[model samples]
Structures are given as C-alpha cells and as structure tokens.
Target: MAKSERDHQKVEAAKAVVYIYINHLAYHISPETAVLYFYQLMWDRLTPECLPVRDALTVVIEDEQFKEEQGLQFINRSYYSICNPWHLDNKKRPYLKQIIDRLDREPETESINRTTQALREQWMNFSKGEYGDCLRRQMHLGGHEIFREEDREFRNVLADYLPDYFYLYRSVTRTPDIEQLEQEHSHPEYSGTATKQINRLRESYDAVYEYRNLRQQGVTGIDHPSRLELAEFEKGLDFYYPGRNDSFKSKARTICHKKRRYEKYASYRPQVKEYLMESVELFPARTKSKLTESIDRALVRFDDRTSMDPITSKSLFLGLLDSVLLPVPNTSNILRLERCVGDVGPMNFTGMLLSLVLACPMIRFRLEKKLGYLYRKFEGKSLEGIQWVVDLFEHINLALVMNARKIGYFSLTEPLPDAA
Candidate 1:
C-alpha cells in the first residue's frame, strides 16, 4: 500500500504535468513553434513540488540559451541527447561570441509536424504488423518438415513471438462479463452508444490490419511521405520533472485558441483532423468527480441489489481510460520497447541520474548491477532457456548504448567504439 501510494502520487504528478504542457500550446504556441514550446510545457510541470524536474529543465533551457550564444543549433529527430550544429573546433571560433550561449545547448528540433509524421509512420508500421521483419534473426520454421515432435515443445514460444493485434480491444466487440463489469456501464440505454463505439473500434482494427496486410504482400496502403516530414519522435526524459524532455506533457487540458486548429499531421491528409478527433479524447477523471455527488444517491437502490462497493470499484472503473490505450498493437509496443531498451540502459541509469538531479528521496537505483542481480534471482529457472532470454536483454542494452551515442545523450569517446 505504501509503495502503491507513492506510485499513485507519481502518476498524478505526471498527469498534472502533461495537462499543463498540452494546454499551454493549445493556448499560446503556434503550430510551427509548438514543438519548441513543448520544452516550456515540460518546464511548467517541473514546479517547486517536482524540484528535480524543475532543476533539470532550468539547466537544459540554460544550455539551450548557452548554445544559441555560440553558433551551434540543435539537431532534430536524434535521440539520447541534443546534438549541436557547430563542430568541436568551432568552439574555438571567437567570432560566435554574441550567441556563445547556444554552444553545447540542448536542442529542440523535435517540432510538432515532425512528431505527427513519426507517429503516423510508427502507426502505419504497427498497423501493417511488421514485427518479424526487423527481428535480429528472421527464421521460417512453419513447415511440417521442421514440425517434428521435438519442435512442438517450442510451439508456445513461437506463438508468443507471433503478434496478436485486434483493430479494436476486446472491450467493445466482445461481450463483457456482466457480473464483473460496472452496473451503470452495463446499462441498456447506453448499449446503443456502446455498439457504435465498438463498431468504430472494429472498423479501425480491420481497416488498418487488412490494409497493412495488402501493403506487406505488395499492395500499397498509402503513398509514403517525403523527406520534409513532420515533427520527429524524441525520448529520454529529464529528471527535473517527469516531463522536462517530453514534447507534450500536458495534453489533457488543451485549450484551442485558434479558430482553425488542426490535428498533428493534418497537412498530409486533409481528413486527418477528423480522424484524430474521432480517435482521441482525454480520459474522464473530472467527469467521475462531478458525477460522484448525486450518482451515489441515484444508484443506491441499484447498488443494494448489485452489492457494489464504490471505494474498491471506482479506481478499477477509471483505470480503463487512464491507461495508455495505444493506437498500435502490444506487439508493436513491445517491439518498440525492446528497440528503446536496446538504446537505453535499463531504467536504473535514468533513475540514478534523476535522483542525483532531483534530490527528492530514496529510489532503488541499480542498472549497473541489474544484469548480474536479475540473472541470480531467476537462476532456478531453466539455465539454458533463461540465459538465452538474458542474452536478448543484454543485446538490447548494448543497442541502447549505441542509440545514446547516436543521439548525443552520452559521449562515446573511448570504451564503446572499436569494442570487440
């Protein structure tokens, strides 16, 4: 419960931060500069309460100012760290004295358009179910020749590797276990709305999946974008606040000031704005709060019959919306996470750094030693089997280090490169 409380607090803080970020841009920032303003959105979340986040944002913003003072501009779309426009020797150029502040400063190249483009690309890739194509090893063992009795043992693992994506989650299309679902949620009048929502979900799943299937099998789903795409994807968070490095930390309470504002990638497809609005909406935390006052009074008669407990029930009810309900499949998310992990050290490294910067409290930081520790903990499992899995994880870490270097998060001056 104690740990859960801490986690709850963290989630709340992070959510609040996200709300502020999105809302800010919705009000003041232009679509063109929205990407740059994303940094400021992150800063808004890093208040006195979130000191580490605050401090990190301050330093990062300062670095940006410092770099502009020099002659270096930040590169966009790179992960790990801010890459500068100036060369190492360019630091020696005395002529760039006026904007020397920009030298080695953090870059904000991940503009809004770039973000949408990358998201669209990822979604397309995900929709197409392109999981196995990028596997470190792509094996085809789907023949009776290789399906001997011994190979049957590997069937479960093979199935696990196979991606299972539904255009819609089982929530809408599949009938709910009425006994397990909320009473109001299962009401008759709302069934019409639920049916429509379910249809939408199903349509989304089939449209994306079938389209991708055709595309993969030599049918083009849609024409690909050009070099000058929208805002690029960025990751690796600052410690000062949970969202200091996040592009749109506070997206929930977005207030649109523009009369003709569009979705992230609307320019590419004119209909994209409608798709986004239909697809996305903030989860209902405020709705539940407002409904609470009289909802209990009205529902009391039903509750006695249903024997419902509000305290234990509300959180679970709200959790469905609160979760990161991705447009992509779990296979895609897992693959992305694997790819991301390949680029990032296990979260242990980030946690330690955040602690160093934030000075907030104690956290169990151990990425450096995580490899050995996790191995030992799971030792009783099959040695050969577990070792293989561990090896996969290690490979991912190595990849993460590589990504870090590419994005300029950490310098790979000595030990990493030329390593045998």
Candidate 2:
C-alpha cells in the first residue's frame, strides 16, 4: 500500500475500533450514557485522527439529513436507540431487555461475552444501511474484505481485536472478566500490536482522569471582566457560594453594574438593546432578535433587581446560560461557535457571558453542570472542531484563578503549606 493508503488504513481501523466501542456501550448501557462517555472520552483527548471518527459516531446517534422528519414528527431514525429500551422489540434478540435488566440487577461478569456478541453483530450489520454515504461505503468495504475470510480465521482475528473493542468498554459498562478476556484474546501472532494499542488506550484514560481531577478542583473560581468588557469590575465578594443567597446575589451585583461586555466587541449590540447576539449563521434572522431580547431582559433583571428572589435569579441565570452555551439545538451550532468566536474573541462573547453568571454565586455553581450538559449533548464531536469551546473553558479556568486569589482561597505570592 502507498503511504496515503497506509494512513487511511490506520484511520479506518481506529474508527472501526471506536465505533464498536461506542455501540457496545450503547447496547450495554443506555444510549444517552453511552454517548456521554464518548463525549467525555474525546472531549479532552482528541487526536488528529479522531475527528472524522467523532463525526461518524455522531451520525449513528442522530443523522441531521433527516432533520425535518425527526424534528417535526419525533422519529427515532438514529442507529443508536435514544428510546426507552423496554419499548423496543424484545422478542427478536432481547438485547434491549437484557440491557435494561442489567441496570436494575446486580453487576455481572458477562461484559466480555456481551461485548463479543455486540462486536460480531455490529460487524455483520456494517454495510450501507441507514447510515451516511461515507460510513456506508467504508462499512461495505470493511465487511466485504473481513467477511470473505474463512469463518474460523475471521473469529480468531476478531477475538484478537477484543482488547481494542473493550478499550472503552471497561469505562462505560460494569465489571468485565478481564482475566478471561486477556487469556482468550491473547494471540501470539498479533500480541505486539494488541499490546501497543492497549498501552496507548490506558495512557489516554489516565490523561483524561488527571485533566478531570484538575478541572473539578478549579471549577469554582471567579473571573475578572476586562476593563473594556466591564467599566469598573470589583474582585471577589463571596462569589463561590454553592447555593441561593440573597446576600450573595446582592454582593454579586455590586461587583459589576455597568456591564459593557457586549458593547466593545459587537457594535450591533448597542443597536439591538444590548442583548447577547448568537452567530447570524447559526441563528436565523427571525429568531436572532427574539433570542437576544430574551437574554437582554434576563440580564437586565439579574443586574437591576435590588432584592431578587432565588427562584427569579435561578430562572434568569439558566435562561442566560442556555442562550450563551446552546443557542440552537443543532450540533452545527457548536461548529458555528468556533467560527463566530473568530469575529469577536472568546473573552468578548463566551467569556463575557460566563463572567456575568460568575457574579451570582448560586448560578456560578451551575456552570459546571451546564458545561457538562453541553459536553454530553454534543458528544463525539471532534475536539479540533470545538477548539473555541475548549479555549473558552481555559478562559474560565483563568477567571477561577483570579477568583481564588481575590477570595484569599490561595495566594500565588505565598509558599505552599506542608502536607504534614
């Protein structure tokens, strides 16, 4: 094979492994949680080769080509079942029933057996089914070549790749019979390649774990708005409180009053009653004005109220956060956000909106869950494509550092305390 062909082979192989892993999770666990794991896995650990695979898995979840039917009639055309598993046909294979029962019953050591079954089934069904054209073609090619092998040889080769299939399986599903799996999948001929891939997958898992641990530690910091964004910003005033407090809200409003986060970047904000405007490409002209108006009103209420109730603040903050993070329901909105950020930097758009919420400690705490929801919502999207969101996340991290400093949570100037 040529160099390009070799690279293409590698990419396709990676995609097949990832695809099997995700579908295995969907079959073993709920489809939603399965997608969640995929999102969390790739959210912080996407490589150059992971982009197209991410996009392909997304098609399995929800193909946008049939948007009109899915949106209007509430169809479930996605290969991965987002429906209640019990509602699915149980007579045929009982895959859905077994999945639902596993959730309620004790954790079993049947993961390996189930995964092998899922892998074979997915490979057999891997053709030009209801999936996208590119995926269909790739599936047809892989199936044609692989299925042509003698049954015994095919089974042995698939078993060799069991470790690859269970790469993500261990994380999402219950405990598996690891010892048996290792013994069964151990092929002296392909051991070298299998060992290399297993090591790589473990390293990736460790990296993600460390990143998440750091994220959890730092998710509770305050962010300072730039002078251009805010006329005069005050530092922390009990900004890390986890729940609703009228006093906290009052103190928060005092931190920044004349909010100018929207003005300096998008001149159109001043023209449109100072609302947070989503990308024109993402939100249509008809709906854009309405969105901005809703956000603007919420911010005004949040800022101007002297004695805002917890209920009102909660609703207002959630409205603002949703508008900023998930302007539209489409996955393309995320891609559009990256493009939109180019026009106005992250600090101006996403960073600015986040800063507004950071003022309210109650709402500030909700940021973690909201962002997690975004991650799960657009699970399987390539990190490279969503670099802007990642950048905004880093921006939030910086703000948290500042918040920590202002609140005397820690001092950069002082030495660390001994762990004794």
Q: Which candidate should be chosen as best, given lDDT against the real structure? A: 2
- Runs in model 2 lying further than 4 Å from the true structure: 1-292, 297-307, 327-336, 377-383, 404-420
Candidate 2 lDDT over 226-344, as tens digits, reads 21122112212122222226432234454334334332313322332332342232454544555566566655544442334445445655666666555564667666555546555
lDDT of 1 at 196: 32
Q: Count the backbone clashes (under 3 Å) in each candidate.
A: 38, 1
lDDT against true structure, model 1: 0.28
TM-scores for the candidates: 0.17, 0.31
As a TM-score, model 1 comes out at 0.17
lDDT of 1 by residue, 93-164 (tens): 221121222222444434355333332333233223212121111111112123233233343332222111
